[model samples]
Target: MADDGPDEAGEPEGPDGAAGQPVTPDRLRAFSDGVFAIAATLLILEVKAPAADERVWHALRHEWPALAAYAVTFLVIGIAWIHHHNLFHQVRTVDRGMLLLNLGMLATISFLPLPTATLGGHLRGGDASAAAVFYSVSMAAASAWFTLFWHHLCRRPQLMLPAAREGASRARRNSLLGPVGYAAAALIAPLTPEGSLALSAALVVYFVVGRRAPATRTRVLAE
Candidate 1:
């Protein structure tokens, strides 16, 4: 009778020594948590406190634009982080390019507060052109980061989970919308400040509309 033992072929063992490589979701989770924490904390610094004034209404009125900008940027970043977390949760393996892509994404995330504050300052001061420019640039950088990261995942099928590809593609398109819209906005800034702001408004609508698509909505709900 033949004895059952290690194979002479020397194939690698599975996650539990069963068949294939291990999925390290924990490490991804831990790394994501840290990034999210840092990003969230950075958002607060963009939200300056209202000055003490003779009238509470006056103080709030002065700070309202900044507050609004801070809120919007914070929520957008939070949404991106959630999507990233979900995407990585399904991913099975990591590679060098994936690591670089993630680093680029993190780099963009770390810059969010600067542009948030820039938007806030310009909008509050009634410099529409500056606000539009800042907002557009920030959105463009963010979109580029998302595109690069997703491109890597899409190009390298082995790095992604089977169930996630369709959703990831949809999500990537959604992420790309911001930069494209902002690019349009920036182009119009020189000719029309109002038009540029209108473009910015269009970006918000695009974001909301993208989320409402049945498949993405359903997948988001499932998550």
Candidate 2:
């Protein structure tokens, strides 16, 4: 009978004294990056070009709402991608639960452009309140999913690298701000559509400039 022993590096061997199947976050990160890239690209499609018969400059001038919405949504997604990258930097492996939770997050990301278009279409119309509320709610949903994702990682410390553990508690606390801020924006939408939009933009700025995370080296676990 063969002895089951630790390898030369002193890591315990798996079945047959061989290394276990490697479970790394690389594939998950790749898929997420693709989704983020596609979602960002799709936001541009919401900003349509001027009609052929319309005066180009005049039509573009009137499309300011759409243009503005596109820029804001682009920023939202860009910040989301950056945060996602940062979060995954702490992750060493992914399990089934993590995969499902990540899918929920990506679903919200993919859905943002629809509400963005709706908000842009109605921002100057009588239904601005409805459009703005819908957009705010969508943003809140995305933030909620992100909050849940972070909490999941906090709960499952084994999924994270040892070096990353020190920051997990702070990261979990900070995650709550997203859902709360977006929910506040949603609640205020009925009173002031423009204010809701401004609040949403403000949240993006805060995330970008105020909540910067320290850079971490990506450490992959050996197979």
TM-score of each: 0.72, 0.83
- lDDT tens digits, residues 55-88, model 1? 7677667776567666666666766666576667
Error of 1 at 22 (Å): 9.4
Local accuracy of candidate 2 as per-residue lDDT tens digits, 1-223:
1122333112435868776554456677798899989988998897879999999999998988888888888988887887787777778767666777789999999999999999899999999999999998898898787677777778777777887877788778877887788889889999998899899889888776765532332334332
Q: How far is candidate 2 from the true structure (C-alpha RMSD, Å)?
A: 6.5
Instruction: Give lDDT per model, in order.
Output: 0.63, 0.79
lDDT of 2: 0.79
> What's the C-alpha lDDT at position 91 in model 1?
69
